[model samples]
Target: MTNALTITDVRKTYKNGTEALKGVSFGVRGGEMLALLGANGAGKTTLIGILCGLVTKTGGSAEVFGVDIDAHPEQTRSMIGVVPQEFNFNIFERVGDIVIDAAGYYGIPRSVAAPRTETILKRLGLWDKRDAVGRTLSGGMKRRLLIARALVHEPKLLLLDEPSAGVDVELRRGMWEFVVDLNAHGTTIILTTHYLEEAERLCKRVVILKRGVVVQEGEIAELVRASGAKNLEDFYLRV
Candidate 1:
């Protein structure tokens, strides 16, 4: 299978001498679900920000599919959709309008975005609330709405950053079911979360980061076996 994402010796440094990522590198295969596991300030967010064009890389290279980020930034960025950790939509905007507007940013025409918006909202169980404003929805619904907006453009790669944070168990389960189905249908996903068990259950492979660099990476089960740890959480802490 072709790589959905490739990073080679990527580096990032902020002003005041803070290095967010130190030559980090990894590849995620197409149609695979990957868990980017790390503690707070471990460079997980910085790595993701660079991929989504929200942060600039100080050195090295990256590619989405076969397109180089530095050479074809617009093309590479258009191939990715990101669901950020925080809710960023306008509270007063209607649900349907929010998603349709997201598609518009990718140059999708309104005629096409309308029906696509409807389809995505329906799939995410937000169709009935389409006319409602963003602040009117429950916390779980808001999270789902964020997902709807990300998928409106039908990107090849989906970056989910702490998607299940603050979500209840039942809602989180449903959300994961949707994500699992999406991956099964060929959307390559990279998920970053504090939930170790969730990562172990949902992702095929795992990359563990510490102090802004990768310390271990491999198939989930294989890594656990090699580490002689009883479970994923144990292995994570031990590493």
Candidate 2:
């Protein structure tokens, strides 16, 4: 099967002499959930930005389901959804309106966006709070709102960046279930997270990055056994 995402010899360098990514590369299979593990300033966000067209790479290439990100940015972006670490919605806007408005960016009509918004909000457990403003919701609810907004257009590949950050354990587990269901339904997912347990639970494959370079990439179980580590945390430390 063709990969859902492909990055080859990708590099990014800021004008201030910071190299965010240095010849990084990876591939994610369709319908697969892959964990991108890294510390702060490990270039994970830069990589995601390149794929989303939010940041440009100085060298190399990226493709989404076979479409080149640089040559066909609009087309590739249409195939991906992103839930960033921060909440970017208008705090004063109604929950339902935020999602519907986001769908409009993809040229999805209100008539189409309305019901799709309803379905997504319901699935993410945000339907009851649909009339509330973003500021009124709890932290976890706000996170769910981000996921709802990202899924409004139902893209083929989903990029989740530190989604469980600041969320309580129970709420995070609930969010994981929803995300697992999404992957089960064939929505390819690439998750960047600091939670090692979350990564082991949800991802079949793992990629560990250190200082903009890939240090390890393999099936989670195999990597753990190969390193003779009890879990991902130990394996990560060993590497």
Number of the top candidate by lDDT? Answer: 2
Q: Give lDDT tens digits, candidate 2, residues 1-239.
A: 88999999999999898999999999999999999999999999999988998898999999999999988988998899999988999999999999999999999999999999999999989999999999999999999999999999999999999999999999999999999999999999999999999899899999999999999999999999988999999999898
Candidate 2 similarity to native, TM-score: 0.98
Candidate 1 Cα errors over 4 Å, as ranges? none
TM-score of each: 0.98, 0.98
- Tens digit of lDDT per residue, candidate 1, span 155-197? 9999999999999999899899999999999999999999899
Scored by Cα lDDT, where does model 2 land? 0.95
Per-model C-alpha lDDT, please?
0.94, 0.95
**Which pairs of residues collide in model 1?**
none
lDDT of 1: 0.94
RMSD per candidate (Å) reads 0.9, 0.8
Clashes of each: 0, 0
